[model samples]
Target: MERSWTQPVGVGVVTALVGFTSSFAVVLAGLQAVGADTAQAASGLAVLCVLQGAGTIWLSQRHRTPLTLAWSTPGAALLVAAAGLQIGWSAAVGAFVVTGALLAITGLWPWLGRTVARIPAPLAQAMLAGVLLTLCLQPITALTVSPLLVAPVIVVWLGLQRLAPRWSTPAAFLLALALIVGDAVLSGQGVTLLAPVVSLTVPTVTWTAVVGIAIPLYVVTMASQNVPGVAVMSAAGYAVPWRESLLLTGLGTMAGAGAGAHAVNLAAISAALPASAEAHPDPRRRWIASTTAGVTYLLLAPLAATLTALVAGAPPGVIESVAGLALLGTLAACLAAATADPGERLPAVAAFLVAASGVSALGIGAAFWALLAGLAVRTVLRPRDPRAAEKPRSGRHARV
Candidate 1:
């Protein structure tokens, strides 16, 4: 938190670490889902990272908030859906545009923003609980195939997290990397040599992609990812202009179109770390960390070759397993706050389970549907609490 010697650099560093480590797979899958070639997918990631980074900086500083801007996780899931529908890149871009527009619309209308903001804390807690469960599972899943590699790291990380809160994640990550490289050296395993991140290109939208892939991508990203991303930030205590942040991401994606970024929306769970961490306690300083992170991203993201190499060499299992373990603290903290109230915990948990189940009737993800379920439960159980029934007279979701 201080200026010199051991400042808030950790926040930015951690942000970038989490972004590249966890987000790489998501971006690759999303781009591939939309029919992008390896080159195109890499190009898109380079561009997306820069724009997303820049958005993080701008949003954090503008509001003096600590929020980290990130690509949509659910948006990636949307791409998985896009794959099922056999959509094209042109449509994928269009979906991003649509999502950007929807975010803009939500921001411009106070009612939508407020209504979304008003989701009961308990339900939010429940939703976050489910999110944490899924996240915690990633590392465990990784161990099934590579117990020799992942198990020891998990055990060490858990111990470190318990003993040293501030240093746990970074330390564990460093140790994991050491283990990864060490194993290669000792056993003569095929240790991959990684290049650093460098390069940039913008996005180019096509009508066909927009009409097909883009529309669905946008709907799912905004409704499923952005809404909750913003919700996560708000729940953590940073009051932000949702529309402005949305617009920033939209503009970033637009700028990145030529560079090849896809489905750039707010990051929900990952962003929560910097937005609420002790390193970013003074809300204004968070802006510095986030902005610094964004600027760092914009500058470094162009070199996909380097980033890919650096990340890939770590052995996918180690990177993801450490990632899952690192996030445990954040997940725990969120649930603690979300379930502070005993009365509302059940409905909240139910709503969260619905979201976590990944059951989608339409082309949308469960985030939106889960919120809807929670609202319905609240409406039914607490009839007299008119806030559940009355729409915000002014913002985005005020139609009724």
Candidate 2:
């Protein structure tokens, strides 16, 4: 019993640590990109920490499964891509609310879930790849501008990628943190720590934001996070209560929206940590791992503001370098999936280029347009035979 408790608890702590540290920079960048000030961004991060922690605990215990919740990292990447859109903070918050509602509706309406599922894997992957491109390029751009400050971080990341792939991003982030602190102290600009506060904003809904931010955010979260989360748990031999999980995460997203959180959903890559055999030899006891992760997230919640403040004060591109480095693997995976099917390559490329272009028209962002272009190309080029279109393709399903 003691051994069981210790092993799962330890794995749970690692799950929370990796999940938080690995992507918090992207989360902060996304919030800031969408018009959040430092305080509001911190609020977003803190609320997300709390919500995912609480949601994970409830769902894991209620279902007796190693289910974990996470903030939508790909959705955050989409927001980072939307940086130049100039959507106001209130509008962003409103989009968050609408995304939550869409998630909940998907849970209740099977048809809606099926509709989102029908989105071509290649096109979905292409959009995600497109969204990730600009942010992933930041490290290269930063290295050109500040090689001395950025090179060591990339070196550490590369070393870890070969030695311990899972730890690469976290280690790179720690090194970047050290560099940021050292630079600040040496420059006589002391880091100011701030208490975490859940700063609430009155959400303002708009047609532009609804189409621009909310719709793409919803599609990304559903395709990338929620769907993959279920598959991960299933692969672990646990049947996730899909409706319950969706409702819980949807409500959590809404609850945090006023506090500036973009969205929260089922964990994808991080879910494997707590659900794996390494967490516990006995699958029945694995829920303990996820429960522990939830508690760990709560404990880490207060750090959001201090970390946000530190990154805010860091030299330009320093923190962005870390964010960019953290996302390289994801970008590579997306690109691979986007180009997997020869038949879909043209449409996928069309989507990828449109999304990467970051173009906006009539207040809608490129992600929306990218999907439109890909689908249009796909429709024109799709096979006439229904049976042929339904034929299974040989390869792994493309996931964000």
Candidate 3:
């Protein structure tokens, strides 16, 4: 009763397409924001893809789990925000190395891992739910921008979700690809292929970049990406070695830093693609989907430049529609998980609102702030249920 390669392969292909199509442009923009020239940006993208691809392959196989890895998209956004803080891309690279080392150290230390585990599940889900809520609205927004292109994509997705839930994401993804490629063909652009150039720069450290860029990158990536990633995997009933996954991703991040890429970590949304019913019915066999995704990533490394160009030139609404459509299921699940605990509803709502507001305090992103606010609210305004706990009686104390 071995599962056929068909399911795993389909899931793998879906995961890769969604992963790359969703945020690869953001990554390129992040590099350019930080003063990376064309070659450096292309190299950074190539290195990141290769590292995550190889890392995903190794980790999923080693643990026999569906552990897909990805670059820190939130971290990329942070870099984009703090682009002017660093002198050059070299300084950013230094910060990247430091962030990776910090993650590696955290993995080696059981206390830190335990501390992360201690975070309330509701709060974690709230943060993820909040982040996804904004992005998941892209379909509606894209409709306003280009109804002809986006409306059909959403319709196709909804239809597939009702008729064949497992294939909805992949089908939507294939349709988006076709639409984009078809547009290119009609416009006579014809899917131009630009070879990726791999360039490495020696890292230069600056205290400003370390404090401003490194700390924020680490915080956001861990809170927004890795925490939700682990939550997604766990919810899917896959028991992964959190410490090991962090360590491998940390090493990969360091390896890619010199090539101008920032941190890499566990994926939140894309990981679900490989772990869902689409991958395989048997949980034990789902690892193949992640492994296949890794192979797909490796194959796409050389095409980073081309992919980057395609996305950059394509209609903005189209890209957003694809990403938003792919994340719809994950968004719904996160929302449900966040509100499942009635006792934690207030704090979770607070977290969700703050996270969705896209606020950044000082240098840190809203996700960290949301977590802090939620915990504070939960502690200060402890909602007491009369049936929950009882004080010891005076008579019992006397007897003791």
Give the distance in Å from residue 290's predicted Cα in candidate 1 to where it truly belongs: 5.1
Per-residue CA lDDT of model 1 for 41-133, tens digit only, reads: 677777777778767776776677777777765455445434544445655555566556556666677675466546665666555455446
> How many clashing residue pairs, candidate 1?
42
**Candidate order (lDDT):** 2, 3, 1
Q: Rank the candidates by TM-score, best first.
A: 2, 3, 1
Which pairs clash inside model 3?
A: none
Q: 208-327, model 2: which lDDT tens digit per residue?
A: 899999999999999898889889999999898888878888887888898998999999999998899999999999999999999999999999999999999887787898899888
At residue 341, candidate 1 shows an lDDT of: 57
Tens digits of per-residue lDDT, candidate 3, 295-324, equal 999998998777666666677687667666
Model 2 lDDT at residue 16: 96
Task: List runs of model 1 lying over 4 Å from the truth.
Answer: 1-41, 56-93, 175-243, 257-291, 309-316, 362-364, 384-400
Cα miss at 299, model 1 (Å)? Answer: 4.6
Give me the displacement of residue 72 in model 3, in angstroms. Answer: 5.2
Q: After superposition, how far is residue 122 of candidate 1 from its true place, in Å?
A: 3.5
Whole-model lDDT values for every prediction:
0.61, 0.91, 0.77
Model 2: residues >4 Å from true position, as ranges?
385-400
